[model samples]
Target chain A: MSGYNEYFDKIKLNEEQHQAILDAVKKEEALLSQAAENTKQKSSDTAKIRFMRRAGLIASCAALLALVIIFPLGKRQSMTPANDKIPEADTVMSSDIRSEGADASLSGEKEVRTDAALSPQENIAADPGSIPAPAEEPVASIITDAVIPNTAKSDHAFPEESDRSAAPANEPYECEFAHSIEKSGEETGEEGPVLVEASVSDGLLIFNGKSYRYLEETITDESAFDAGCLAVITVGGDALLDPALLDIRSGMFLYGKEPYDRLYIRLSEDRFLCFVPEDN
Target chain B: MKTAEEMVSAYENMLYRAALSHTGNCEDAQDMVQETFIRWLTKRPVFESDEHEKAWLLRVVINLCRNYVSKKGNRGNAELLDIYPAADPEEQSLIEDVMSLPAKYRDVIYLFYYEGFSTKEIAEILNTRESTVRSQLLRARNMLKGRLEAEL
Candidate 1:
């Protein structure tokens, strides 16, 4: 063989070696096929696991709703209109009410008492400790007129002394807010309910969420207020400083120590929604 | 319509040989051949003739083998090269010398002499002009001849 051909011939495989190469090729092909199959199965299993997880999430949500319906406590009443009368409780419980075990009947069936049909008077009388004096009298009277049996209305269920004391009375709250907001760019002031989630610095109320600091001079109106307090003016949720009652929205600026002497800005409406603690 | 079975059967040996020339390992050569066959089957190239089909398969196999060899590194991995020994004194020395040569010259020599591809075929497979292929082959031959003579 020529020098060049010798090199080529040297590189060439014998029959046995050629067969070995073919066998290797076949083995590699089988491996690729196995890898492809494994990938497919893995993808399908992953999809199934994801689907099951989603279904579990939905089922858990449904179970939580069912649990809420199975238990009831009287705390803050549900704000929703599903119930006609508020339970006579300082704190309204959630909707579901289950009766504790009663003696089994001859038929061995459980007896359950549903709270839905209870008269307002009965519910209120059941927990006199929960009623607020004076503030709840009118509401209780309305409930008596609307829900009590005719004979029960004539019977005084509330202590007569409690009746005299239950009339609504005006409660005044001195409002003060720590003004802490970084005041810059077209000055914006928020007046209404002061947020309790705030830190108060020397004559400045730092809004808990908003990082703003305002000067006491910028408070155009002033009124009676306490430090570290938030007054939730019922109407339009106007939380503001008492001594500095400036209607920043109307562009009306009041200047004086008794800034609150200016007409109390009713919520959006001219009626008092209620004075709630800033924490509320 | 070229079928995968026919293509695999027709060019399997050629692809294996080309991969062996590039990787100098029976296992990697086999992988390159299998991969090349798969690529060919997937692309379903409409070859002008059997020669075109063979050349395309060999080109893919060589390129894949080259990539594998480089990724594995050419030095200090005796375990891989031990499976497939060089065929003769000339061939073994040629492979060692080519392996030492820069990849550009080694590619041309492997395609031209070991693979038995003409300069024109090499040019077509390499996506270069025919003149470039001819010049490359001449340069590769000279480089290998010099290196082999130096070894002797």
Candidate 2:
């Protein structure tokens, strides 16, 4: 073992080799330190990028939330009319007119008699304490027109006839009807006109279980009608003698003469009826 | 933990000699020693005593040399004798014989004879059982004895 020790002990590095190892160790340490510093710098850059991305996402979300909150309020503000702030009497009169329009058939005769007994100005003068006079002439005229029935205003049954004689010959009379479809047939029975079921299918109007080709020019707009409802067919504002059926869903009213006469149907606020000719 | 210069100065020669015996070449042995020091610098292992530090360095160098030899499939270089020539013919012959031994045998012999480690300490350094180290030592000795006797 001593002999083996002596042999192994003889093996030693020269001065040059020892210096080379020291130099290599120094070089490696520098490289490692530089690598660690670069890694730390990369980590910092990554963290900054992540923070900016998160901030951008948060900002986008906040902008969307602000739009969501503001949009509905803007719409509501636009919906309210600027001229809605009227006097108390005008407001009451407008409300009464709307109620009368709702139940016009039941109480229409009584309102017409009252309006006939006293003029708008005479009524305000006679019952100055109970009824206040309208501040404006246009407002007073609107109240008179709403209260007075078409039959009371003229001898003719239809208001369009009176409108043609009173107003300019070129101007057309526009009638604004109530937003209700009255089922007259079942309720009135034999006393009044019977309104049967009606439908429009494939460019043909199915009325009283008979298909009739309606005038194409009369159909100003295409409106879909619902089922299981009764409607009356009116000619020159008068119900047909045979009592034709019409499906008046969506507050629709079908009127006008047949056999090439103009038909009027009111479906929506912006849309009106297309007439059906008697020949078709 | 010691600085690179301190570690290199303290254990470089010892590690180099052990690496040389396992690697069988001066260039590979120096490379193994340098790599061992680099690891020591990077790892910064704490030691209780000088012996513990020396043992740790020797184990690292020996393991590095083993890995180099395994990867390169290098047995022994004939030029090993030229690097450090002995004064006596017999001592030179003994060195050659020791180098000629298997890597495991040479490791146990170097730690036991040159480093003055017990069989148990040699096993711990080599990460083997003490009985295995003892058996390897005995077999290495018998092979050396036979070669020396034949030469004589």
DockQ per model, Cα:
0.07, 0.51
lDDT of 2 by residue, A1-280 (tens): 5656776677787899999999999899898889889999999889989999999999999988988888787655532321121132233334444553344446433222123224434534554443312223342233232121122212323224343234222212222111111233333464322224344444344455544333222222323322111122332121222323232222222221111123333232223334333232
State each candidate's chain A TM-score. Answer: 0.24, 0.30
Model 2 ranges off by over 4 Å? A74-280, B41-53, B75-77
Return the DockQ of model 1.
0.07
Fraction of true contacts retained by every candidate, in order, equals 0.09, 0.80
- Model 1 local distance difference test score: 0.45
Worst 10 residues of 2 chain B by lDDT: B75-84
TM-score of chain A of 1: 0.24
lDDT tens string, model 1, B1-152?
75455656666666665666556566676667767766764565888987887778767876786677778865421432355455667765655666566555656676777567888888888778889988877777788778777888
Docking band of candidate 2:
medium
> Second chain of candidate 1: TM-score?
0.76
